[model samples]
Target: MIAGRMALGILVALEVAAGCRRGPAPAEPVKVIVTKNGWEPWKIPARKGEKLVLLVTRTTDETCATELVIPEAGVNVPLPLGKEVRIELTPERTGPLRFSCAMKMFQGVIEVR
Candidate 1:
């Protein structure tokens, strides 16, 4: 009975420790719609180190889809039309990150604060 109690105590202690330990909280994904004209939100504000998941959905039937050109990150992603694309952005610095379409006519900015 004593050994069983000790084992139970150890298990309880381990459970408590495991509860106290926490991994990174799940990141909140941001949903943004993309149109032929431009991005739904011309400017989006985000905090540094915060995970930014952009759910870009194409809204136009035109051959144009939102293309993100992040010079800072050196990432270029082409968002297809009639479809959704997930883009993760973890800004290391606080500044404005520009994004545009292939034609460069449509543009948006991601402001990292």
Candidate 2:
């Protein structure tokens, strides 16, 4: 009976060990709201060399804010009206990367520290 209990305990421990996460944990995507004022939570914080996923949702059809531009990262994405778009990036360095509208009238930043 003692040997069986020991084996059961070892199995449970093995299962627990297997469930533990290894290496870099997957980062949850950040949600950004786009309105007439541009991106909400514009200043995004991220770790260096970490992959970031920005999910942008446009809540208003005001102006020409249908498109997004991240000049430094060379990302120019068109955001559909009242729809969501995803932007994935891995920041290699630490600094502020700007994201703006096509007309550059509205802007925001991704702060990597």
Candidate 3:
């Protein structure tokens, strides 16, 4: 029973840490994991006009999310398989900015505050 309690505590701690991975919490640059399954943490948080460093890593070759597009910023960057694509942008206004693949099949959003 004691061992189980210890394990539960550890699991809870880990879960809390994972929950805070993004959302203006960490000092590190924002990162998104791209895979055949789709974008992990699809919603990104940012403040308008504040520079954001976005690091996107494509972990699979079969995924159709091969490109990242931000129409307002005039960005259409490609993500090569097994590579990380770094993008920098400053949200010009408060609203949802959509980013998706070239095919428009997979999509995500940046919530500018």
Best by TM-score: 2
Which is the leading candidate under lDDT? 2
Q: What does the lDDT come to for candidate 2? A: 0.73
The TM-score between candidate 2 and the true structure equals 0.76
C-alpha positional error of residue 2 in candidate 1 after TM-score superposition, expressed in Å:
63
**12-94 per-residue lDDT for model 3 (tens digits):** 11112235344544335688998777888789998775666788998987878888876556567888887877787666668
Residue-level error in angstroms, candidate 1, position 9: 46
| Weakest ten-residue segment in model 1 by summed lDDT | 9-18
lDDT of 2 by residue, 1-113 (tens): 45643432211111122236466874898999988777888789876777677788999987777887876665778889878887777676677777889988888888878
TM-score for all models, in order of appearance: 0.69, 0.76, 0.73
In model 1, which regions exceed 4 Å deviation? 1-23
Instruction: Please tell me which model should have the higher lDDT, number 1 or number 3.
Output: 3
Q: Candidate 1 at residue 87, lDDT?
A: 74
